[model samples]
Target: MTFDDPAVADELILPNFNYLGYLAQGSNVAENRINGAFARLLTPTLAFTIDSSWVHQNWPTGRTSGFDKTNIGLKYEAFRDSRHEALVSVALAWGVGHSGADAPDTIQPGIFFGRGFGDLPDSVSWLRPFAITGSVIDEVPIGSGGMALAPNATTGRFDTVLSPAVETLHWGFSMQYSSLYLTKRFDGGPPKDEPLNQFVPLVEFRFDSPRGQNTAATANPGFAYVAVTWQVAAEAIIPLNRAGGTGPGFRAQLLLFLDDLMPALFGKPLLSDRPAHSQIAW
Candidate 1:
């Protein structure tokens, strides 16, 4: 029982009266998510974006799950250099997904590259505040029980991600590592495979109000900056009897932001709604 013994695996923006949504419940399962996006700015570097998402999951043995995804995108900054204070950007994305037992029909394509470091100073600078990104995805698989679970499997997959970010005005940080490689084809012989890895970390804080009339157009306004975020992940599933080893799984997440919630929704600020939390192991 190795693959780390137990393992499991598993966005934002708005406008034009836009919307973003989240709901979560734990101790078995419950999840809901919604997202919408629209952007067009064909110059000043070029841009276009359209996005959509809906996800729902519920389990208590009585099983219930759902999935939906849609995306269209283009973004470009090509290159920028303000006397060696550099910046560059590129993006392309396409996605499609619809449920069957939580996703089977699929098509995805993505590419991204970014770098920016505007001179260094502000306190022990590491390339100003650091930035690096890389992404790739090509996945296509349709139905028939997902083609009978790896039957001549080569449904396509290749992934990579590395991110580093930091900021100061209060506090902000980011860290990420991802790897995916799945390629194997066997209908009569020779082709066996396994490789999947992921890790992520993040920290955040900010509160600024020097008058507050444009603190991002206030809707849940009246903030001077407050943020708390935590995440943990691990996965390893490579077992084809190579010493009978490797099978592991773990996940953790937590988030909190507070300024007001009607004094914890009416108990004089002792509120508990468990904001955006997640965990899984198998």
Candidate 2:
């Protein structure tokens, strides 16, 4: 559920719960997925997160569905400065290995960064709405149990199974234009309505490549409506190559800011029962 964006969750002081629905057409049947993410702030520069997904697979002759293993992670804002509208962060996560699920006790370490043009001169204030974010991660399997059935040399038959996993790379980047930031920080006149002022046109790229394996990627272009307590985003998924997918797809999501919806309760950092009296600037 994490989009590999540096400024994710930086706009508010609250925790978030997001639900996403996905759809894609395959060679024979349609594939669908349901994903969710729960993120909580631990401090001004730290956060905790949990993510999971369920998939519905379809084929010409058969169909199946199952839930993927849950992934738990933590993120630390390594550097930040609102004056420049920039931030840097690092994260680590473990995919809980489970039978009938996914992965093999996998670990992912990633770096993220985001920057905006808000600090530009007034003559180019319009460009201030533009921003960019990116992230890259290393995927590793803990144990050597990722095996596939292979032919046994001694027996001269397919009777052995050998580990098949290798180090993989997961990466993504995004370009966005935040209407909210443009008007709220740079404009002289009042802004538009609540959700309208929060529009952000975004394009995201996600890719993966395993050692000695083919590379695959997906590009998503869409707009998001961000609000104080919630957000909704929709994107059109396009394949970058043959390995990416067959054709265009789509994904829609709804996110709820628990902190804003119930600031007196869930909005505060997890380390403290109540919101901090003094804000920490980074």
Candidate 2: misplaced stretches above 4 Å?
8-29, 99-102, 146-163, 181-195, 273-282
Writing each residue's lDDT as its tens digit, candidate 2 over 164-218 gives 5578898888888877654444352226444364788889998888788678788
TM per model? 0.24, 0.79
Candidate 1 lDDT over 29-114, as tens digits, reads 33444444543334434456665645454433332333345656565555555444334445554554332223344444333333
C-alpha local distance difference test of each model: 0.29, 0.67
Error of 1 at 174 (Å): 5.1
Best by lDDT: 2
Q: What is the lDDT of candidate 2?
A: 0.67
Candidate 2 has a TM-score of 0.79
Which residues of candidate 1, in runs, are more than 4 Å off?
1-29, 32-56, 59-61, 82-115, 121-282
